[model samples]
Structure formats: structure tokens, C-alpha cells
Target: MVKQVRAARTRQALVRAAAEVFAADGYAMASLPSISRRAGVSAGALHFHFASKDFLAREVEDAAADLVQKMAGEARSSSGTVLESLVGTTCRLLVAMAADPVVRAGFRLGSDPSRKNGPGVLAWWRTWVHERVAEAREAGELADDVSPEGAAAAIAAATVGFEVLGGADRDWLCEERAAQFWAFVLPRLAAFPQQAMATVTGAGGVR
Candidate 1:
């Protein structure tokens, strides 16, 4: 039992260390030795846990995807309207990316063109955003001038942009920046901006 626990802990540490290295250095530049050193594990142990860098990268992306799904599920179950739920989720996502290296690396890896993998976490996020935006449109929660596709694209692009910027400066992922984004878009996106803003502010959307 102790050996199993130790093994699990070692795997977790390796994943985290790899995420940090990948988040900082990108996939092409991240190395197995560096990840092992950061994790405080020997190369042999890292190899035992993960066969290759690609496998480790996939593990990080998978872990990050799970977190994103959890966040989306929470937002979907929130008592607020669809628009408010979307806003809340976006705020949570930026905050997560800011604080969690796993999430940060997941997004970074998802968007890295150098990596020959599939769309990864970004595609999952964008799909979720589109679904929610479409739901909001169907429910008359969005402004008449707004199209679901356009709103989804804009929201996805903006959030992904924040993740990218936050990579260099965490201030980009601050709550204030998220609030500013909602403030700028709410007027045009929400059918009743004031009510949505009120719910948002009360629900930790801003401040």
C-alpha cells in the first residue's frame, strides 16, 4: 500500500513539474531531465512513470481537461441565467489559469502549433462556450443583435487571448481584467445587461 501511494505521489509530482516546464519553455524546448530535476525525481523514475515527453504532455493536457470540464459543469448548474453562467465560468477559467500551472500548461499545449497532437483542451473549451452561447440565444438571454456563433467565437477568442497574455504577465488573468472584459461585452451581449451584471457581481464575477 505504501509503495502504491508513493508511486502515485511520484507520478503526480512528475506531471506537475512537466506542466511547469512546458508552461514556461514550450513543448519543443522542454526536456525529460529538466522535468525530472524539477520534480526532484531521477530520470529512471520519470521514465518509469512516463515513457516519453509526449506521453507526459498528454497526461498534463488530460488532467487540465478534467478541471475545465468540472468548471463548466459547475457553471452550468449555477442558479444564474445562461449569460450569467457563461460570465461566471469565464471568470473562473481565467482565475484557474492564473493560479494553476496544470491549467496554464494545458491551454498552452493545446494551442502550441509545434505540437503535432489534436486540438486538445482549447477545442473542448470552445465547444462548451459555443453550446452555452447557443443556449443563451435560444432562451432570449442574449441581445437580438448578437448571433450565437459570433458571440461564441468572440468569447472563446477573448478568453484564449487572456490565457496567452497571462502566460507572460499574470496580471492579464486578474479578476479586474475579466470584469473589464464583461463590462465591455455585456452591453452588447446580454439582453438585459444590468440584471446580468448584478448577478455577476454578486456571484464573484467582478471584485
Candidate 2:
């Protein structure tokens, strides 16, 4: 039991360390030795858990996707219009990414096309967004002209772009940018009725 716990801790530490390295240096420039050093683990120990950098990158991507899924679940459970839920979820995710080194690195690494390619983390997010948009449209919250697939692609692109921009420049105004995005998107999402707008403003105001 103790060995298992230690192994888990070690693996977690490695992932955390790798994420920081990747976030700072990007996937192409980050190295296993640097990650091992940051984690205070030997290269051999890191290899024991992750055979190669690609494996480590995949693990990071999985961890990020898990985080995104959790946030999406939370948003779905909260009370609000589909658009509000999406915006709230996006805010939560952005906040989490800002605080989590692993998540930041995962986003950075996953955004790079030169990295791993099996269905990728961003693709999963896009699919999730597409499904949510379709659900909202069916519920009569979205405009008749709204295309789920197109909206999903746009949202995904905007989100990734925001994150990349925020990460690159410390002085970038993240909250301002997010608010601008919401301002522009909310009206388009509320093409149906006042009730839909109320859903976003009432009890579940993207807390």
C-alpha cells in the first residue's frame, strides 16, 4: 500500500514538473532531463513511469481533458441557459488553467500540431462544445440559423487563442478579454426569447 501511494505521488510530481516545463518552453523545446530535474526525480525514475517524452505528453493531455470534462460536467449541473453555462464553464476553466501548471502545459502542448496526434485533447473539447451547442439548439435556446458544428469550431478556436495569448503575455487582460467574448457571444446565443437571457442572468450568473 505504501509503495503504491509513493508511486502515485511520484507520478503526479513528474506530471506536474513536465507540465511546467512544457508550458514555459513549449513541447518542442522541453526535455525529459529538465523535467526530471524540476521534479527532483532521476531520469531513470521518470522513464520508469513514462517511457518517453511522447508518453509523458500524452499523459499531460489526458489530465487536461479530464479537467475540462469535470468543468463541463459542473457547468451542465448548474442552473442557467446553455450559453451561460458555457461561459461560466469557460471562465472556471480559464481560472483553473491560470492556477495549474499541468493544465497550462497541457494546453500549450496540445495546441501544437507537431505534438502527438491520436484524436488529441483539443479535438475532444471541440466535440464536447459541438454536442452542447446542438443540445441548446434543440432546447430552443439558440437561433434557428446557428450551426452547432460551426459555433463549436468558433468557440474552440476563440478559447485556444485566448489561452495562448494570455499565456504568452503577462500583461494581457484575461478577464477583459473573456468579458468581451461573452458580450459578443451572449446576444447571438439569445436570439430566441427573453427567457433565455434571464436564464443566464438569474441564480446561475456564472459564479
Candidate 3:
């Protein structure tokens, strides 16, 4: 029992360490030795848990994807308009990126040119944004001139930009920064700017 508990702990530590390294150095540049050392585990231990860096990277990406799915699910289930849900989810995501290295690494890994694998977390986020925008359009929540695809694309691009910029400067992910973005975009994107702004304001822009 003790051995099992220790092994689980060791694996968790390795995953966290690898996420930190990948978040800082991209997947190709991140070395196993460095990850093992960061986890305070021997090389043998890391190899026992993950045969190669590819497998470890996949693990991190999967974990990150799961987190995003949960966030999206929460937004869908919440008692809010599609537009309000979209704003709330986006703010929460940026806040997560700022505070959680694992989430940050997941996004970086998805965009890293070094990885041959397709974008994982990023693609999921884009899809979520597109779906939400489409739903908003159907509900008459978006401005008449706003194209669902265009709005989704712009929102995805902006959120990804925040994640990339936040890696170097956390201020980009702060509540004030998120509020500024929502305040500007909501006024332009929503069918009723005042109510949309009220929804975002009530949410308090990221905790």
C-alpha cells in the first residue's frame, strides 16, 4: 500500500515538473533529465512512469484538455446567456493560465512548432468558442452585423494571445486586463451592449 501511494505521488510530481519545463522551454527543448531533476526523482523513476518524452508530453496535454472541457461544461450549465457564458469562461481561462503552470504549458505545447502532433488544447478551445458564438447568434444575442465565425475567430485569437503574452508577463491575465477586454468587446459584440456589460460586471471579471 505504501509503495503504491509513493508511486502515485512520484508520478504526479513528474507530471507537474514536466509541465513546468514544457511551459518554460517548449516541448522539443525540454529534456527528460531536467524534468526528473525538477521532480526530485531519479531518471530511472521517470522512465518507469513514462517511457519517453512524447508520452509525457501527451499526458500533460491530455490533462490540460480535461481542465478546459470542465470549464466549458460549467459555462454551458450555468444560468446565463450564451454571450455571458462565453465572457465568463474566457476570463476564467486567462486567470487559470496566469495562476496554473500546467494549464499554461498545455496551451504552449499545443502551439509549439516543435511538436508534430496537431494542436490539442488550443483546437478544443477554438471549437468551444465557435460553438458558443453560433449559439449566441441563434439566440439573437450578438450584434446584427457580427458574423459568428468572425467573432469566434477573433475571440480565439485574442485569448491565445493572452496566454502567450501572460507567459512572459502575468499582468496580461489579471482581472483588470480581462475586464478591459470584455468591456471593449462586449459593447461591440452584444446585441444589447448595456445588458451584456452588466452580465460581465456581475461576474466580477476573473477572481
Candidate 4:
């Protein structure tokens, strides 16, 4: 039992190290040797845990997917309107990306064109946003001038933009920025003033 526990811990450490390295340097620049050094593990141990960099990256992506799904599920289950739910969901996502190395690395790897057969977390997120926007539209939550497709694309783009910009200035992930974004789009996206100007938890989530 102790051996199993130790093994699990080692694996976790390696994953966290990989996340840190990947988040800081991105895919093409990241190396397993560096990841092992950061994890305080030998290269042999890293090889035992992961066969290759691509393999390690995929694991990071999988972990990130789990993290995002949990947050999105929480937002979806919130006793709030669809628009509010979307706002909350985005808040959680931005916060995760900014605060969690694993998540940030996962996304970076997903979007890295150099990595063949990448996990495509960005694509997954786009699909998720697309579905929710469609649901909001069907529920008549959207403004008459808004189309579900357009709304989804615009929102996804903005979120991606934030993640990219946040890489340099973490201020990009501030809740104030998130609030401003939501407030700006709400008027054009939702019909009711209440929904448009709703008090939303912004990037990095509520304090």
C-alpha cells in the first residue's frame, strides 16, 4: 500500500512539474529532462511515468479537461439563468487558466501547432460554448439582434484572447476586466437590462 501511494505521489509530482514547465515555456521549448529536474525526479523515473513529451502533454491536457468540466458543471448546475451561468462559467475558466499551472499548460499545449495530434482543449471549449449559446438562444435569453453562432464565436474569441494576453500581464485575468467584458457584451447579447448588467464573477472568479 505504501509503495502504491508513493508511486502515485511521484506521478502527481511529475505531472505538476510538466505543467509548470509547459506553462512557462510552451510545447516546442519544453523538455522532459527539465520537467524531471523541476519535479526533483530522475530522468529514469520520468521515463517510467511517461514515455515521451507528447505523452506527458496529453496527460496534462487530460487533467485540464477534468478541471474545466468540473467548473463548467458547477456553473451549469448553479441556480442561475443561462446567461448568468455562462458568465460564471467563463469566470471560473479564466481564473483556472491564470491561477493553475496545470490548466494553463494544458491550454497552451492544446493550441500549440508544433505538437502533432494535440489534445485540442480549445476545440472542446468551443464546442461547449457553442452548445450553451445555442441553449440560451432557444430559451429566448438572447437579444433579437444576436445570433447564437455569432455570440458563441465572439465570446470564445474573447476568452481565448484573454488567456493569451494574460500570459504576459496577469492583470488581464482580473475580475474587473471580466466584469467589463461581460457588461459590454451583455447589452448586445441579452434582451433584459437585468441580464445585460448582471453582477458577474469575472476573470479569476469572485474574491
Models, CA RMSD each = 1.7, 2.8, 1.7, 1.9
lDDT string for model 2 (81-173, tens) is 677677777766666677877667767877786785664667777788888788888777778777777788888888778778778674232
The worst-scoring run of ten residues by lDDT in candidate 1 lies at 198-207
Model 1 per-residue lDDT tens digits across residues 91-137: 88999998899999999999988898886999999999999899998
Q: Can you write out model 3's per-residue Cα lDDT over 1-207, one digit (the tens) per residue?
A: 999999999998999999999999999899999999999999999999999999999899998898888987886687479987887788778888887778889999999998988898999999999998999999999999998889999999999999889888888986667778888888889999998888655435732
Candidate 2: TM-score?
0.88
Instruction: After the best TM-score superposition of candidate 3, give how far the Cα of residue 201 lies from its true spot, in angstroms.
Output: 2.4
Show the colliding residue pairs in model 1. Answer: none
Worst 10 residues of 4 by lDDT: 198-207
Off by over 4 Å in 2: 170-176, 192-205
RMSD of 2: 2.8
- Tell me the tens digit of each residue's lDDT in model 4 across 10-118: 9999999999999899989999899999999999999998999988988888898889988889988973677877887887788788899988887888778788974
Over all chains combined, what TM-score does candidate 3 have?
Answer: 0.95
Local error of candidate 3 at residue 155 (angstroms): 0.4
Top TM-score hit: 1
**TM-score for each prediction?**
0.95, 0.88, 0.95, 0.94
Tell me model 1's lDDT, rounded to 2 decimals.
0.89
Q: What is the C-alpha lDDT of each candidate?
A: 0.89, 0.76, 0.88, 0.84
- Ranking the candidates on TM-score from highest down gives 1, 3, 4, 2
